[model samples]
Target chain A: MKIGIFFCLKVWNMNAKIAIQGIKGSFHHQVAQEYYYQNVEVDECLSFEELIDSLMSGKSDQAVMAIENSIAGPIIPNYALIDKNNLHIIGEHYLDIHQNFMALKGQKIEDILEVHSHPMALLQCMEFLKKYPNIKLVEDKDTAETARRIHQNQLKGIAAIASKTASEMYDLVILAPEIQTINNNMTRFVIINKADNFVSKNEINRASIKFELDHKRGSLAAVLNVMSDCKLNLTKIQSLPKIETPWKYSFFVDVTFEKYEDYAKAKALLTIMAEYFKVLGEYKNTKP
Target chain B: MKIGIFFCLKVWNMNAKIAIQGIKGSFHHQVAQEYYYQNVEVDECLSFEELIDSLMSGKSDQAVMAIENSIAGPIIPNYALIDKNNLHIIGEHYLDIHQNFMALKGQKIEDILEVHSHPMALLQCMEFLKKYPNIKLVEDKDTAETARRIHQNQLKGIAAIASKTASEMYDLVILAPEIQTINNNMTRFVIINKADNFVSKNEINRASIKFELDHKRGSLAAVLNVMSDCKLNLTKIQSLPKIETPWKYSFFVDVTFEKYEDYAKAKALLTIMAEYFKVLGEYKNTKP
Candidate 1:
């Protein structure tokens, strides 16, 4: 009880600033805004791995990593760092990934001969890219930088796959508004911090854990059955291979328990789970 | 019997062609070679997400996602995709991420006033960047692409951060070889597919799992204890917040164990891991 109280006090003293990857106006920047609010400062990094490193090294108090998106799916490279760094997920942020094909003012859509953006941005605009065959597709470092590139170069024949913020920042006109091929394009961001930070009240519906199962056949089935038999609703499931194994994976699962009772039951079922696997952590989620 | 024969006959038919995100000679390209070998055909996508989509659509038999580098640490964005994708990890690849500082054929390192590359490439060459503080740092997309960009634009007094392959590909001169700030930098890649195609090898020694907890105190300790009791060594651990909850995490773990007895013990411990969490999956590593 003392430790818990001390931990909360420690949290209260923290600046709680959330670090985000990308320059200002990047999607991660917005997600950090959603969490850090007026009092928090959003720290920027050139790469996602550095963002986590900054947090792990005491440079920042927290971080938000783009996990998965509606059209593109998850960010796979981030998983390696999240694994390498011991940062814990404290919250989740779902941001609307609104993309725009922006170009310099007075540059007509027909004037565009190339589209540049972060790979995902270009891909989200793939269907649009197909429509304009002459517009060669290229990738920039980030969505915001894409706009910055066109503006700095004063390139008339180039457009950028970027966000509304990026367009506004670079004074670029939107040739194609919401050019993302999918209307449902959304990126889920996971806010991470040192393992000792507060889990937060917002985490009631969230849980996180890790485990390993035997290599034999039916081992995976037995592991999944633990969730199904307990009647827990699984929202997401993904597995990554260990560096030492062949054709085996360690799985990550997100489960939605309609009631607290189900959550309790699911936790209880982990006892049987540990019999066949290795449990990592079961922690609550916080929304930002 | 039929299933066993079907499995037996399927052994020789498994020809996995993996897609990776990069141009011809990025670190990811090298890693793909580690897994699929010279016989394998590599399909290059511009983005990591596209590689995942390629696997999703069966456009590529498998996809290789760079997870982390030893000296550079984790590639955190890839972790998000791993959590978001339905693809299973069937293998692992490690590539040395060596960086070369390059420029136009006639240019000397002393003559260079600007450096360009993907931001991460720049970061990997941070020490190099620092040494030439007067030089402007320009961010391009990929290391190889950056080299290509330098060649295409014919920028004066400029250098690029890329691999030896980029120098060879673009016919540029390596102004400074092995200029990465981190000399020991090595990247780990995961070859993912829709199917769990493992031809059992007795030497596989590691596994991975993801899980969520019941939002209780001591949950992490409870799970860690399981690994400790079973003597499983954890090489990596990452926690991402569960979106459904405002402040909870789903933890991913990479644990090391040897042989049948150890694998069984690890699984047994994971079964009980649920007193507070959910069990995700146990995986075998395929890194050669």
Candidate 2:
């Protein structure tokens, strides 16, 4: 009977429509495929705002958004978007980002005169690109989209810093592989959905939370102390200025705990301590 | 005698060569000019890395770089750049950013087919641009450079979102004024110089610091408690992952205080409590 119930749950999740921030062969698309065990429908979005819209409007059952990268750090605007839209992060996946230099199959590295990619991709691969001072670097909207455009337009003397998947999908040859400045490039993507989606309590060991504190001395420290006393491990903390109220900030944190009771205890205490508090998500710890 | 000393100081500062990340009319240029009262040589660099090279090689006496914007939050990589270079921040300036839409005199807003600017500028003015759905939004290297290009090429039906100074320098007419989503947009810039240039103790009230805490529970909280006890106001806090060590983080914080002794006390305490500590800058608090 237990096996039958688990099979049913998996079958139900198989039909989820996942919204992503870019077209096929993009990192978002890659995450969607690797994260779900079964085949899922993908609703391609050209931007994060559109991805949120698709989820909110019921066009897609869930969304995958890149929240942070090891090198580039957090994507602040996306945090605001998830908070403002009341979206919940159900899970997260870390992708080993390998930026490859690709162009038309017949072209060599020396033939490239210009390289196009997303600004972050260009920044990550700056050390390698610096060796060729003569090549002009152009910023584009997407990494894979640039590769697709190059192939479709039959462009010459142009290269793209993208993923190996993009090269295969676009029928281009990768001139150089894993050209990022740091070999250990990783991007953390969060799986998000509407607030109503529920996960089993026993499966949750991590949470994303946001809160605001009063202008008291060591107010943040006090809240953090509460988290520590409850045996919660603070993995990440980011403070974003409340735009309307210049100096005031709202803190977003990710924490993991061995017991749900400990998180519950901390939540109760934080609710009383903070002027405003909200749980952005409760999910299984990807790292733990 | 006092007036004569002041006049000599001003004359000495007049010949100082300043390095900025973009050409004249960019926001960096605006800060460079407004921060100094007299004429100074400007060494334009296309990238932040180049800007650092100019400063390190003694090609420029000082450098001006934007640290944070009210709308977009912090520029993380720049923080790493400043910390890694061992540069000193002698002063700071707050520029009220006004993104104006400009084009050739004859073209109307409806006549423009494409708008080009830095990605951050485009994001700041996104609310205004959404109305013109027909116009293509293109990201370029620099806002002022895009305006100059449109002027130099006499490109018809092209608009650029840049500073008011850019319009005047490139002879472009403003199609719309103050087009940023927020009317009170502000960007904080830091004036950096070699470590040997020092500001008097009485003039210093703010500091930018970087430190790393051990893995002990409540280590961060303990450090914050020390800062609070020393009467320091934590204006900003950002955590950057130590790239080499996956889970460990190095914190960058900005603090302000009423007395220099309080800051010194906190620095001493943090030095003892943290595994590693460094002061990125000691300058007057621009906001305070």
* Local distance difference test values of all predictions, in order: 0.66, 0.86
DockQ of each: 0.07, 0.62
Shares of reference contacts reproduced by the candidates, in order, are 0.02, 0.45
Pick out the ten consecutive residues of candidate 1 chain A with the lowest summed lDDT: A278-287
Output the lDDT of residue A41, model 1.
73
Task: Give candidate 1's TM-score.
Answer: 0.59
Which parts of model 1 are misplaced by more than 4 Å?
Answer: A1-101, A104-154, A160-288, B1-16, B148-158, B165-170, B243-248, B264-288
Candidate 2 chain A: worst-modelled 10 consecutive residues by lDDT: A1-10
**What's the CA error at residue A126 for candidate 1, in Å?**
9.4
Second chain alone, TM-score for each candidate: 0.85, 0.95
Q: Please write out the lDDT profile of model 2 over residues A67-87, one tens digit for every residue.
A: 988887888889988998999
Which interface RMSD does candidate 1 score? Answer: 10.9
Docking class of 1: incorrect
Task: Please provide, for model 1 over A146-220, each residue's C-alpha lDDT reduced to its tens digit, 9 standing for 90 to 100.
Answer: 788778889889888887988888889998898877676667788676774455333446655555665543444
Q: Please give, for residues B108-210, the per-residue lDDT of candidate 1 as tens digits.
A: 8889888877766776677677777688776665678777777888876988888898799888998789887656566677766676544343444666566
C-alpha RMSD over true interface residues, each candidate: 10.9, 1.3
